[model samples]
Target: MNTSAPDEGRIDTEVRGHLLLITINRPAKRNGFTPAMYRQLAAAYTRLDDEPALRVGVLMAAGDHFTAGLDLPTFAPLMQRGEQAAPAGGVEPTEPGMAGYRRRQKPVVVAVKGITYTLGIELMLAADVVVAADNCRFSQLEVKRGIMATGGATLRMAERAGAGNALLHLLTGDEFGAAEALRLNFVQKVVPPAQVEQETLQIAEQIAQQAPLAVVATRLNVLKAIEHGPLAAMEEFEATQQRLSRSEDAAEGVRSFVERRPAKFTGR
Candidate 1:
């Protein structure tokens, strides 16, 4: 643990090569987020956004369970005070019960294991890719708790898993195994518990090896397409290509790709 950057009891970050791995470390509590911890996630995402050295970021949890949900006890005070539209320092929490609202640009991969309830289930929708253990359970239990999903889930859940299934899960707040989640596109890949992290990291490593500028531009276009329409996304896509095609890195990518070598991108 780095005493220099102590972050209460929520997250632990380790930078591995060009990949930044942020683990929800309160596994003893099933990785629930404290209000302070919730606030830090957005700050961390902001750091990830500006860091040119990192091409990929990851969000995962330790132990068998991914997360039970927010630390209601710790955050209940904030709730009693009423949820602010955004966090005080402008780093706002991860969109209130939603995941993935704090970040975009770089591709993010989530590795899931064990039980995932509430925010944990919603979190998968936020990542570009998800690799999960076969044994993991997925659920949306906020309705059962007399709460609604405050995360991006309310919007993206139907898009991710089809409206029928999303309604079933959200309305009933039942738990289902990873096989169902995989079938519904909630997770991109499912493997044994032993290989989930390895596979996820490998996927991230491959993403990190691509041309940095092009990668981020691709992410932006894809996210724009998701939020807007294909026509609008296409407009940005053309401009992105036109802008990138003229850069030195563009030529380098082709040269290195043809030479079967790593492209030393200056991010030009």
Candidate 2:
């Protein structure tokens, strides 16, 4: 399905089976995100969560580069006014205190290539899994631009890439290659440029094939464990297990296992 945001057409959306394919379309500017672009991207993500048919989302770019980060010139006025930009039609991708506000109950995978700067890196970090092209270059250059990385980078970077490694790049605003990103755990996988999208889609498809409720529960459990403590996560274990056990999909799962056939989950 074609799900283009209302204005500018900066973000493109396509539905393939249960996967929502969201592509950054402003390649001419190396996918630099203007305010309109951010709104469109946020709208797509919100649609993914709101639509029950969409079990997973794959975020990739249309051009060689994933994104050049924010268009600082266009955003300078908002920054000067100390105002947070709001999305035009969807949930805000970043909240006041939450890190990675785009993280929905459903899973999201990201594929990146070429120059991924500032917000680009943060977007990757926000995703459940990342696939980076060999030619991908990443940098959190906000500090160099006399601004700080506010798009969940400060909160999520250390958690994903270790405090020392995150600071090394954040402090210096230096560019790093895909290999470095992999080593730092910034990216989950690295493939050739030609295969980045394919690989990402494959992973998203695999996740989409699973029972949607179980998949969402698993992701939520992990996030709860990370954001809260193990004790807090454990608190939900019994309740969640009991709830799922009574679900129709859970019964189907057991019956399918007994029949030695692939389970057809209905997201019950």
Q: Any residue pairs clashing in model 2, and if so which?
A: none
What TM-score quantifies how close candidate 1 is to the native fold?
A: 0.89
Q: lDDT for model 2, please.
A: 0.85
lDDT of each: 0.76, 0.85
Give the number of the best model, judged by lDDT.
Answer: 2
Clashes of 2: 0
Residues 178-268 of candidate 1: C-alpha lDDT, one tens digit per residue? 8898888888898999999999999999988878888888887887787788888988866788999998999998999899988888777
Question: Each model's TM-score?
Answer: 0.89, 0.93
Off by over 4 Å in 2: 1-9, 88-90, 94-103
The stretch of ten residues in a row with the least summed lDDT in candidate 2 is 1-10
Residue 87's lDDT within candidate 2 is: 47
